[model samples]
Target: MPIKLHDFQQEVVNKFFKSGSLLCVLPTGTGKTVVALEIIRRLKEQYGNKTKCLIVVPANLRSNFVDTIRKFQLKLNAEIIQKVSQLDQAYRTKTILVISYDFMRLYALKLLRYKWTLIVADEVHYAKNRQTKNFAVLYQLRLNSRHFLGLTASPIANTPEEFFTILIIVTGDRSIFAEGMQLIKYMEIGRKDPTWWEKLKATLTGRRPRSKKGELIPIGIKDIEAFRRLVGRWVYIPHYSKIEKLGTRPKVKSFVVRVDLDDFETKAYKYALRKIPRQDLKDLKEGTITNARLRQIKNIIMACQQTLLSPDYIYEYEERGQEGVEQSNISLFRPGSKIKAVAKFLKQTGEKTIVFSSFLRFGARLANHYFNKLGIKSREYSGAVKPQERKEIIKQFEEGDLQVICLTGAGQEGMNLPSCKNVFFLNLPWHGEILRQVVGRALRITSKNPFVRMFWLFAYTKDGQETIDLWLSNLIKRKDIIRNAIFAALQETTANVSVQLPSYEGPRPKSKRKPDTVLGINYPR
Candidate 1:
């Protein structure tokens, strides 16, 4: 039996057929794998059993792709080879070989020697980085393969140079540089005030460019309308409020105990300040101390020091009788401190929750506080975990043995965690794509839960609030676009209906009780 294809899959396969070397940019869950399979089938038909196909995927997702292929039961012989030594003479007989990015470098020379009919690159966005060893190997394979296919949810790189690297892999042409440069130049001319010289550099290096509308457009392969439609369907449940409404809210409370930094933090701050040359400060413009500027090591240490020592210098309240005596040195964590508050609330309500932090160290510290100090069962997934161990940890969580899982964004993309009802963003991801993917883990429709609750922990700081606001605003805009697109598609389909007239022609019926006063008005009684 032939494999069935989704609309998007069919479209991608058709493009692959038309363009021997094609780069496919589809959204997640859009059946990129299915398209690749179809391409393999088509190639086998054209070249018979002589054709060999190589599929490259991210290191973390190597097993996931292997499992998918096994489930599909395709005719092609597929093996997930992790090491170069494993790709001996016996492995060469297989039609499709799946290798992780890390192993690509070791086997590139040998792999390139073979007559690979098709080279399918999964997560093809990584190919844009020419400096990477995997990318260099893949580029050589692109030259060797009769046909090349690049697959990614979002293949658009941060710069035009990266974008052309992907294009070069697909088409083996340097001319895309000229096209991208032209677009960038056009964009610079159209804009009244360009934000950064980097933008111009991006155009020259294939980093950034203007859309046809002359707007600064990021590199993205996804159909905007499709992404919007998918996101709009995301069911956001206000679990915290819902439980409160049911009168079974979590009872555990959080207390923010502020400690005065005993000289260490103050010294660190002073050292940081001294490191910044006086000339740099003299040249600095007002309002230049934004998060981007403050991200420097010195500035960050200074800020940390200041925050640590704040409790000692900044008093909450002063008594009239004793001027030096402080009324309250510590402030209680309120409902607004979403991270701790949510954790506390979940503990009270007796629900399993997942807390995501951008920094592994911060996540581990938070987990230790909850598990070690508070005795709340919590496990962490971070960069520290070995690949083999990460799988085992995931298994433990999925089996309901764990109460709370504090993880960085490592497990967001491909890992399945249907048991988690609540997802708290302890720290927001910088990119919108990452944020969406992280939230998506909990929103899987196949889960037993009805709705997923997402809590974004935004600090009272302007930057934190602005990040949350921007995310919300973008979500709303995308939702509207999706809703409109769905409606428009429906209307267009309805409008295209052709009606056949009966043989007998009669005068159009007129009465219908004067159309039952179609227009209603506010009438004075």
Candidate 2:
């Protein structure tokens, strides 16, 4: 079968012009990878079989490239090699090499030695920080970069400069930005579109409509089927009752546990905050660091987060533990609300849980300090873990050999642990997208248990000293905005189609969310 492109996808790809460097920003499920593959096909046809391409993706996605290559029957010799020693073993012939971002950073100089025809970076938002290894290596790689393609679903950045900065790394020439900006200014794309097109465009851009534009009508199971026929892969959301009847409903209950930071953590956090400029803190949350001092900033951020868990060095947060903490008590060495919260939840539920942490160091610390101290079998999953060990860890967790597994971003997407019904975020998520991903680990249609419980732990308080997470708060608000947008879109798009589910719920998962906005852009609903 030939690859099918939707009107929206075809339009975007047709407009791309296949210039030397390109940034393709499309939503998830809209087939960004398909667009990328199409671009590679055209390039290979024109540039000949000798053209070399490099795709740097998340570690879990290493096999996806190989599978895609096989499925499409692309003649390019594709290899997913992260080891620097193995690069020599690879054929000198033109090939497409797949690697992780961490590998690129680790072997930046070695990989840069290779002359590449094209470079494609997926999940490009991670390249926002210039001081970070990814950004630095990417900057240097641009010197030899010829054809470049950047792909991402979310253009996550607090500022336009930060967002466009990654394009600079891709393009290698900053002058292109001036030309791009000039083109954007003169372009008619952003101008007001027609009413019907505007509504469709809002859906395309993930914007919430201003109001509920249609009415919900009572319909039978056939109606739901029609809706599913119209919009593929989204029927499971609105037709909840029908799906539940089919035993496909994944029950997910979410809670946010409010906790306060201990004095040691407070002191460390305050000191770190004082050292860095205030805006940088906000920028880091957005995953964009314009400042070159990201090493120090990241260290400071790590220290603050570590205080919640146990830092390797006791002196990281304070010279000692709390004022009267006993030397024998584990709290003496490791004491914070995050640990206490996890320990409490584990003791209470005694259920296997996956505690997710933002940083790999924090994940390791949490497993070692809290879970191990509780006499529970625990493991850590991150980039540091060998691939084989990661598979072993997952197997152990499934077999009940491990009661808990502390995970970083590395383990979020790959694991299909429907058997594990409990997930705890020992730390606040950077954004709503991450929160969704974390919950998705345990919450699935095929969940082993009937219910999945997720506890999202946050340190929010009246006092300004402990921690402030406006980003998390605001990101969550968008969830409801998105939900409402979906509801309205369904009601309107499916109206003529006459699709609905009989015996449906009173209302589609009510989220008492008022209108909200982010970065001054009104998220319509």
RMSD of each: 15.9, 13.2
Estimate candidate 1's alpha-carbon lDDT, on a 0 to 1 scale.
0.50
Candidates' TM-scores? 0.62, 0.54
Q: What are the per-residue Cα lDDT tens digits for candidate 2 across 1-525?
A: 335655545544554443456666543333456666776676677778667788888887777667766877766677888688777656365477888998888888888888777788887777876567887787777777677777764433232333446767766766543432221111011112213212332222111123233211111122333433333221111223322443543566555455666566665555545655676665544423322334456555555555555433336334554342223344345545666767666766667788888755444544546677778778878877898888788888887567788888777554657678677776655445565556656655456787666665556332533253333443333222323332334422222111111111111233578434322211212
**List of clashing residue pairs for candidate 1:** 159-206, 159-207, 160-206, 160-207, 160-208, 161-205, 161-206, 161-207
Give the candidate number with the greatest TM-score.
1
What does the lDDT read for residue 369 in candidate 1? 52
lDDT (tens digit, per residue) of candidate 1 on 17-114:
87677777543433567778878877888898888888888778777756766778777778888666667743557888888777787667778777
lDDT of 1 at 109: 72
User: Considering summed lDDT, which 10 consecutive residues are worst modelled in model 2?
Assistant: 496-505
- What is each predicted model's overall lDDT from 0 to 1? 0.50, 0.55
Best by lDDT: 2
